[model samples]
Target: MKAVVMRNQTLVVEQLTAPQPAHGQVLVKTLACGICGSDLHMYHHCENVLSGFRNANIPVAFDPRQGLVMGHEYCAEILDHGPDCDKKLKVGTRVCALPFVISPTRFEHIGFSTPYPGGYGEQMVLAEPMLVAVPGDLPAPIAALTEPLTVAVHAVNRAQLSGEEVPLVIGCGPIGLAVIAALKARGVGPVIAADFSPARRALAEKFGADQVVDPAVNSPYASWLQVAAPSDYDMRSPLALLGLGRQPRPCVVFECVGVPGMIQQMIQHAPPRSRLIVVGMCMQSDQIEPLMALPKELNVHFTFGYTAEEFVHTLHALADGSLDAAAMITGTVGLDGVADAFTQLARPEQHAKVMIVHD
Candidate 1:
């Protein structure tokens, strides 16, 4: 199989052995895959790449330095099933499988310890019960967004924002924008999105963000707070009062920036009795003040990836057009173009979601 192989940070289109389904795995034909921010981290060594190795939960067995088929956000068609696979799945069926196949109970679980021989090639193997059937109406390119969209949905769900609580997402990357879209579909209260990128802010508007804030051009907390009603502006600090609209106060803050100090800033800016959801993967050496949690009476919710049910919800939202995954696709590249895509993604402020289309 032809794949975009990365060896010692050098990416080349090379032929590699296709992965076979293990005892409980399924072989899936790679349809479409989305390049995530984390992939760029590994590809570029992002000033703190070693942390990714330590963060991965699987046993230390594979060496990413030698080369790994790196890509996780994808939708595939089942081509074969392992001997122990369930009979529910059929060949040619479209499905969005969980890229993270980690289970403390399973003996051969492929934890994030090593890159999970992801969907960057023509075919790969995925664990059973991890792949969810995508609706027919959801195109493969759009369904490819299931994993990233699920990340956003999981963060919002963790933040505890419902119909009664307004959400304030503190970034406008693909994941942050997905949070805005998911919040609208779930009938959650008004949402405000913050980002410094003009392109992403515009995309946020398309995804139903009531208002967009460019933190560099405008003070996100200030601009958002002024429009917030007094109840929404309950941050208790006069300095935090900034928005000009009469919107509800933000009861939940989704800090998607994953920057070193952004979480602390959100906790300080957020109102009392609010929860902050950490969705972004930041550099490992970034220092944070842990004591603020007690003084501010803050609740921090750390969430990663998605559960089976949320992945299904993500697929449903995409199939029904509740979330525009197609629009999130800022660029698409072929196997040979993986290196350039990584370069562009490194400056994500310049691009949204970049898709890797298997030819």
Candidate 2:
């Protein structure tokens, strides 16, 4: 088998033995796998600090220590089933799978810390609990995106927003665009997407953002104020000088960029009782005024991964064509290009979703 691996903070693609499924697991032939933000983070040395944090760190659900495969967002075909594995999926059945697997006991022991193999290789051994059967008709590239789409789905679900109102999403990167697509799937109308990249804004519009804000050109501060206000601009406060009126905050806001400053800005411009879900991997400790968060009585939620049921829902959504995962996938490379893909992913203005093609 061919695999891309991280050894001593460096990445290389090399030939390796194919893995056999253990009890309760199945062997899968990787068809397509999506390069995620976290993969890039690990490639550029962010993983060492972030993945090792016992309390605050974002552990790569899958670790290279256990003979890791680097890709997480992927779809595969069941090739062989182990002795205890349920035989519901046939050899040719296409499936969307969760990159990480955790047992109930393990879940209780460590809330969100587990080491599971990822999908950036020619073959993988998938635990039954982490697998979701994908539709045969869906293209492999589209099927691969179910992983990230589910993240967006989970974020929206965390918001607890009603159908009566729309939502605001900060940052128009792949994750933010996924939020827009998922919001639309759940019948949420007119999602506002914010990003500094024009390319990203265009992608957001392609996905379904009713409005796009470019902080570099139009001044995000000014644009946010213009739409969110109506009252006294004393021209004294920073918010007032930006020309933003009183906040007519959206019912729900998804903070997908994870930038430290954006969180505080959202708090300032948020409506009286808006809910915000933090979805981006900011990679740093944020400093903000404590009172700003205390006064609004806002609900801030963060989710790790989609539940089993949500994973199935995400696969179904992709299969039925409710969400087009293909659009989110911007590039594909062979096993050898994994390192380069990671480098590109670190840049904010690069491709949307970069896939490592195994077939």
Candidate 3:
């Protein structure tokens, strides 16, 4: 199998032994996989991710010294089934999965498991129990988004949002765009979004943000001032500079920008008693003063991964055409180009949802 792997804190493309599925598993050929932000975190912060895995009680430590294949957002096809594997998916059946593989002894994440490999490889081995078969007509790249879409879906769920709440989202990356789309699909929008990229701002509107702000041009909080007039901004505060003082601000804010001060910024300007959902994956430790949020009594919510039900719900939504992910894909690359793809994405919004084609 040809795979893109992390070697010595760098990503390299190589040919590795294809994994064989054990009983209740199946061999799958990768059709398409999306390079996830988490993969980048794993690439640069290998030790931190290993610490997380250890805390999560993963029996097998991630031995970066041995190399690791990384990708969870993918679409695949069953090549062969192992003994006693469920035959519901015949060979060539197109599918997506929850990015988990359950071995007899323990459960492990697909992309992180060297033993099972991942969708970044030309071939992967997946647990049959986690597979979700999609219609043959669903595009591979779009199908590959099921994992991330579910992630956003679960984020929306965490909010327990009503169509009435005014939601402000920070960032226009794939997850940010997905959150916007999910908000629109659930009739929750005319939403506000902020990012540093003009390209991503345009993409955010296409995904259903009624308004978009470029923080690079000005603090995104500037635009929110009109809706949320806390007090006299004195022209210096981010909330006051945008000529604010309309009505009060929104009740909820989605912090999708994964940077050091995003959490603090969201906390600093959030309306009293508002809910702040932290959806971004910030890799490093930070010094955030709890006192900032304490006075406002803001509800801080942190989330990770989706339920199996949410996974299936996302697949069904994509397959049935309820979730139009055609706009989510920004680029395509083969295994050899994956490392570069990661580098490109690391820039301030160079692209969104770059798909890795196994073929």
TM-score, each model?
0.87, 0.86, 0.91
Pitting candidate 1 against candidate 2, the one with the higher TM-score is 1
- The numbered model that scores best in TM-score is 3
Write the residue-wise lDDT of candidate 3 on 1-359 in tens digits.
78888889888888898888888888999999998888888888889868866776755356788889888898999999999986888999988887776656877788887676777889988888888998759888998999998888999899988666778889889999999988888988668899878889999989989889878776666666555544554334444334345435446788887778888888787666678889998877656779877766678898778999999988888889888878988899988888788889888557888999877
| Best-first order by lDDT | 3, 1, 2
> Candidate 2, residues 214-279: lDDT per residue as tens digits?
766665444544555455543236554343565444557788886678777767766545676889
lDDT, residue 151, model 2: 87
lDDT of each: 0.75, 0.72, 0.82
Please estimate how well model 1 matches the true structure, expressed as its whole-model Cα lDDT.
0.75
> Which runs of model 2 end up more than 4 angstroms from their true locations?
46-52, 56-67, 104-116, 219-250
* TM-score, candidate number 1: 0.87
lDDT of each residue in 211-281, candidate 1, tens digit only: 88878787676665566546544455544344334434556788887778888797766665567888887
Q: Candidate 2: minimum summed lDDT over ten consecutive residues — where?
A: 107-116
Summing lDDT over every window of 10 consecutive residues in candidate 3, give the lowest-scoring window: 234-243
